[model samples]
Target: MKILCGSAGWTDKTLIACKRFYPADCRTAEARLRFYASQFPLVEVDSSYYGMPSAANSALWVDRTPADFTFDIKAFRLLTGHQTVRESLPKDIAMAIPETGKKNLYYRDVPAEVLDELWRSYREALEPLRNAGKLGAVLFQFAPWLMCGPKGNAHVEECADRMQEYTVAVEFRNESWLNDRHAFDTLELLRRRKLVHVIIDAPETVTNRAHTLWQVTNPELAFVRLHGRDAEKWNATGAPTAAGRFDYDYSDNELAQISGPIRDVSRRTAKTHVIFNNCREDQGQRNARTLMKILGR
Candidate 1:
């Protein structure tokens, strides 16, 4: 299942051809979804960012996406350490969990019990997609604070453990984890756990490392995210979310480099999914169209 093309589902102002995923395009949510589905066979929903969608929303998504199309959803922020909260107790109890309002390995501190509850609850949300055969990989884009080391490896182990418990593909952030110089223990760990690595494509900069997410040998589902090649923005702030510098596009050379990696991984796999997050404007979308045209997908 090599994914020739795909775009991040966000209601951006930039208009793109082929198709558009309205992740938060709730302005005309259903219509946006339908519109995109009409043009593309797949969509990567950012719904997990805001936490699992309600049952009604899930039902709506199931009803909207055609049987042949697909939806790749990232894991919720809560499940990962991208967000933090007090792990509030029930309305009746008022005070039970941590008052420090701890996070998780990515952010605030959280009790194991809270994490267990959160993971189980969110896992349930994917049931509809699973049942419909539309469930894509669960990308767990861990927070930047999750710097790699002994601690990072521990986090990886924990995440892998959870994914195995749930039986899903996963993705990772933090350059340390992707560094080729680093040991392959982590990569092997993912392989053993049967977790899919989320290959990242961003400009080579101090903040961005050249990482290949093809650890999962099968490549049944290759996940690639083009975070844009804004080297200056990344190098200057050491942050990927600095300002939007939509001044560059994937040159032939750059795309050539990427196509190789995709081909390398896909050569042995069944399917691949390439997403363009350089979507500050229509950069990612444009690249996707170009790749589609070039690859004749």
Candidate 2:
């Protein structure tokens, strides 16, 4: 089994400021990526969720990393039906919006043409990485409000169709998608579409939206994201940033419990990506390294 381990983002501010993961010389973006690539085989690009990535940067990443290094980029917030701040979008995309005064816009609020443009822009941005064989999967992590049903399922198909050129991974924040009754059905949906099911390690509570389960829908690639078991902040609506919500760190026993499932998934899939998403300071980076050692990778 080809198993790769890494953290969500290498360029996270806390990971750099914490001064525990990267060396002092890894100050520049290029240097940081190069160093990170040397240590880990894969990385998840979380910044793309905030703003569309650039082709130039993607190309640079290819040049900076090792030949086997891979990047899994998150879908743009607007593309995933999340409430995106208009200002964070590209100038042209933002200007095209009818309600310029509004602070945020949902995926449904955007016009068809504008949404198509956004998709085009994202595809183009990732082309460089794809061409270089540095791209793993484009993650479409839908918002918690995007529930399970025919409508939600159709949207998933639409996203898959839009990115047909690349491998797509789907992560649902809505627990309804993975409830006891719908879990197997949802897995079948992903299997039929050849979409990588993003198995999550989050708070094991119904209200948390994300369910902590061991499921592998895609035999080609099993992608696991560990967001830690921070139940207190799992549904904390008032949290200002992602770090606040994913604040917990895994203890030794916690990692041991997850290790078994990861190994089981690895045996079934051609490749497995174990990504630690607890992006609070150096917690994720440390845990990723720890998990790697635990898994004997």
Instruction: Name the candidate that leads on lDDT.
Output: 2
For 168-279, candidate 1 gives per-residue lDDT tens digits of 5555556676677663866776677777767777665555454655555334666677777777765564556543643356876677667877777776667787877665
List RMSD in Å for every model shown: 4.3, 1.5
In candidate 2 the C-alpha lDDT for residue 225 amounts to: 91
Q: What is the lDDT of residue 269 in candidate 1?
A: 65
lDDT of 1: 0.64
> Each model's TM-score, in the order given?
0.80, 0.96
Worst lDDT 10-window in candidate 2: 205-214
Off by over 4 Å in 1: 13-27, 85-96, 101-108, 165-167, 208-210, 213-216, 235-248, 251-253
Tens digits of per-residue lDDT for model 2, 1-297? 888998899887877888988888777998888888998999999999998899988989889998889999999998898888887888998888788466789888888999899889989999889988889989999988888898898899999899887889999998899889888889899998999999888887638575666777778899999887877787677778657768888998889778999999899899999888899888988888888888888
After TM-score superposition, the amount by which residue 173's alpha carbon in candidate 2 deviates from its true location, in angstroms, is 0.7
